[model samples]
Target: MLFTTCIEHLRTQPIWFLLISSLGFFTILKKSATFLNWVFITFIRDPKDLKRYGSWAMVTGSTDGIGKAFAYQLAKKGLNLILVSRNSSKLKSVSKEFQAEFPDTQIKTIAFDFSSDILEGVKEIEEGIKGLEIGILINNVGVSYPSAAYFHEVDEQVWMDIVRVNLEGTTWVSRAVLPGMLQRKRGAIVNIGSGAAIVVPSHPLYTTYAATKSYIDQLSRCLHVEYKHCGIDVQCQVPLYVATKMASDIASIKRSSLFVPSPDDYAEAAIRHIGYEARCTPYWSHWVQWCFAGLLPEAILDSWRLSIGINRRQGKLLIP
Candidate 1:
C-alpha cells in the first residue's frame, strides 16, 4: 500500500520534476527497503565494499544466558560468529543449536575461562581471529557473587575474581579485537553494565561488580567521544538483575520487563540497537540517570543509590 501511494504520488509530480528530485527519491524507495540497505547490497555486499566486514560477531562468555542470546539474534541477522565461554560442552551445545536452527550462519567457539588468566585467553583469541573481519563485538561477559559481608571481611580472592572476570576479561577481549576495528574504521562494541552504578553507594555483595560496571559505563561513553569521527559505535547495555542462574532466587526481582528478563528477550532488545545513537540505553531510564547525574548532588545521589542497593535487605547485606 505504501509503495502504491508512493508511485501515485510520483506520477502526480510534473515530468520535469520527475527528471529531477522526485525521480531520484522514487528510484530510491523502489529499489530497497531502506536507503542504506540498497547501498549496502549494491556496493558492500561482495569482494567489494558490498559486504563490509562479512557479518562476524565475537561474544565473550556466550556459553549460556545473555551471551548465548546475542549469538542467536546475530545469527538471524545473517552473521557468522565466534562464541567464547569457559565451558566447552555448553559452547558446543549452543553452537550446535545455531547450526541446526539456522544453517546459513557459521559458528565458532572458544572455551577459556576468564579468571585471572584472561590475558592468555585473549592472546589465543587474537591468534584464532587473525584473518577474519569481525564487524560486531558484544562484550557480554560478567560475574556476580551473592551474600555480602563487610568490605574488610570479604575474602580478597573472591573480590579479585569478580574484578578479573567482570573488568579484565572484557578489557582484554576488546583490546584483542579493537585493532582491526580501528584499522577498518568501523565496529560496534557493547559492554553489559548494571543499574546499580547510578543508584547504589555500595551493594554489600555486589560492590566490586558495581564498580567494574561503572568502569564499563564510563569506558563506553568515553570511547564514543574518542571514536565518533572514525565511524565506530560504542555502547553499554546496562540493566539490573537478570533471571539467570545468578539472580533467579533474588526476592527483589519482581517482574520480567522491569527486573528479570530472560536472556533471549534482553538480547533481542539489545541486538536491535547496533548503533550508538545514545550514550546509554533502556532509553528512558538512562535519560533520567543522565539528567540526575547533572542535577543531584553526589552525596544525595549516593544516599538514594544506597537505598536501591539495599533492595529488600534494609540498607545492608542479607544474613542467613
Candidate 2:
C-alpha cells in the first residue's frame, strides 16, 4: 500500500519525477562499461598495436609539416617508409636523412604533386610499392586557400587546386592503396582532416577547402564501416591548428603552443590514435576546446565564425 501511494504521489508531480529519473539515467551512464572504455581510450591509450596493420607505412606530402612528422614517427617504430612529396630533391634529402637516423628501417621515395595530375601520381605510387607489403597509408597530402576569402572572391585556379590537392589526392591515393590492404586484410588508413570540416559548427570564409576536408571525413567514416569487419581500420584525424608552413600566415599559429601544437607533437598524438577513434581531435587540448564549444548553440558558433572571417578579411586582430 505504501509503495503504491509513493508511485501515485510521484506521478502527480510529473516534472520532478522526470527530472529525478533523468538524473538517475545519466548517473548510470557515467558508470557504465562503455563510458569507462571511452575514458581509457581518450586519455591513456597508446599506439602499441600499430604494427598489426602492416610493415610499411606510406605518407604523402612527407617532405615537410605533419606528413614528415608522421614519417619520422613511423620510422621510430621500425616501420619502413614510402615518402611521397612534390619535390624529388627534397624527397631524396628526406629519405637520406631518414636512412642516416634509422639505419635499420628501409625507406623509399615517390615524388608526386597533389596539385597536378593526381591520377598519374597514384599510378606512380601503385608502381612504386609493387610487391611490397604496405600496412599503413597516411593520406596527408592537402592544400588550403592562400588566405581566407569569400567563395566568389576565390580564383578559379585556386578553387581547382584546393579540391584537386585535398579531395582528389586523398581519394585516388586511398583507392590505389586500398586494394593492397584488402589483399592483406590487415591495414590502416589515416586521412588527415581539419576541424573546419569535422569540428566547427560552420566555416565561413574558406568554403571550398572546408568542403574538401568534409569529404575526407565522410570518406573515412564510410570506409571504416565497410572495412572494419575485414581487419582494416580507417580513421580521419581532425586537427584545429598546428605550427606548419601552410598555417604560418596567422601570427597566433606561427609558434607552437599547448593548443596549437607543433607538427611533430600533433603527429605523435595523432599516430597513437590511428585505429582507435574514427574521427578524433588527436590533441587533448583540442578535445577540451570541442567540449566547451559544444555548449554553445550552432547559431552562436556560426555567427562567431562569421565574425572571425570578417576580421581576417579586414586585416584586423582576431583570435583563431
Candidate 3:
C-alpha cells in the first residue's frame, strides 16, 4: 500500500519521478554489478596455471606467515620454490618441511635480510636464480611498528627499518627479478599490501607502515601498466589482518575470526587472485570490510582509526 501510494505521488510529478527513478535504477545497477563481480572473482573464476609463467616461484620472507603459506601453495601446484628470509636456521627448517611434504618440488633457500644491505641481498637473489626460470615473485616481506604509538613517539631507527624493509626491499627485489621476467616475456609479481593504506583514510599511529604500503599499491599499478603488454602481470594484494606473529604482537589479534583469517587460509584465497586485477583484497571478508569502509566519510574513518590506535596504546583490548 505504501509502495503504491509512493508511485502514485511520484507519477503526479513527472520530472521528479523520472529523476528519482533514474537515480534509483543506476544505484541498483551499479550495486548489482559489483556484487556479481565479487561473486565471480571470489568463487567462480579459475586460478591461473602458475606453471605457464615459469617453473620456479620465488617468495620473500617465506619462512613464516603469508610468505611461507604462499611458498607452500605454489609448491603444491608443482612449482619449484625459492624461499628467502633473514634467518638461515628457519629457512633450513622450512625447506626441510616443504621437501618432506612435496618431495617432487625443488626448493632453494636464500638468507638475506631486507632491513640491512639491500643491494647485497638483491645481488644474492640474482646470483641464486641465475639461469633458473622464475615465473612468479611474491614480495611479501614487510615490517611494522611493534604497537600503536604516535609517529614522534617511535624511534627513528624503527621507522627507518620499516621503510627499508617495506619500500626499498620491494623495489630492489622487483628490479632484480624483472629482467628475467622481461626476457621471458611472461611472469607474475604479487606484492602483499595492507588494508591500513588502501581501505582506511588514515592509520595514525602506524603512519610509516601505512605509507610504505601505499607505495606498494602505486608501484603495482604503474608496473602493471608498464609491463602488461610484455606479458607480465603485476598485482598488489591487500589483506586486512592475518593471524600471524605480526598481528599477534602488534595488532593483538590472538585468534583468527571471520575478519582475521589464518595465513594459510588467506594465502589459499590470495593464490586464486594472482594475475588478475592490479589491486585486490583477495579474501572475501576483507573485501566486505573494504566496502563498508568505503561507505563511511573520511573524517569518521580517521577518527575511528585514531581511537583504535589510542586504545591500543592505553593497554586496552580493542579486538575482542
Which number leads on lDDT?
3
Which candidate has the highest TM-score of all? 3
The true-versus-predicted C-alpha distance at residue 140 of model 2, in Å, is 0.7
- By lDDT, highest first, what's the ranking? 3, 2, 1
RMSD of each: 11.8, 3.1, 2.4
lDDT of 1 by residue, 16-110 (tens): 98788967888777755654653443335432121254468898878777788888888877788999888999889889988999998888888
Q: Per-residue alpha-carbon lDDT of model 2 for 169-199, expressed as tens digits?
A: 8999888888888998889999999988867
Clashing pairs in 1: 43-50, 44-49, 44-50, 44-51, 45-50, 45-51, 46-51, 199-305
Looking at model 3, the pairs that clash are none
Candidate 3 regions with alpha-carbon error over 4 angstroms: 1-12
Candidate 1 residue 227 Cα shift, in angstroms, is: 1.9
Better candidate number, 1 or 3, judged by lDDT: 3
Question: In model 2, where do residues sit more than 4 Å from their true spots?
Answer: 1-15, 18-38, 250-252, 317-320
Model 1 global lDDT (CA atoms, 0 to 1) = 0.71
The residue-level lDDT of candidate 2 at 185 comes to 88
**Full candidate order by TM-score, most accurate first:** 3, 2, 1
Specify the poorest-scoring 10-residue window by lDDT in model 1.
Answer: 42-51
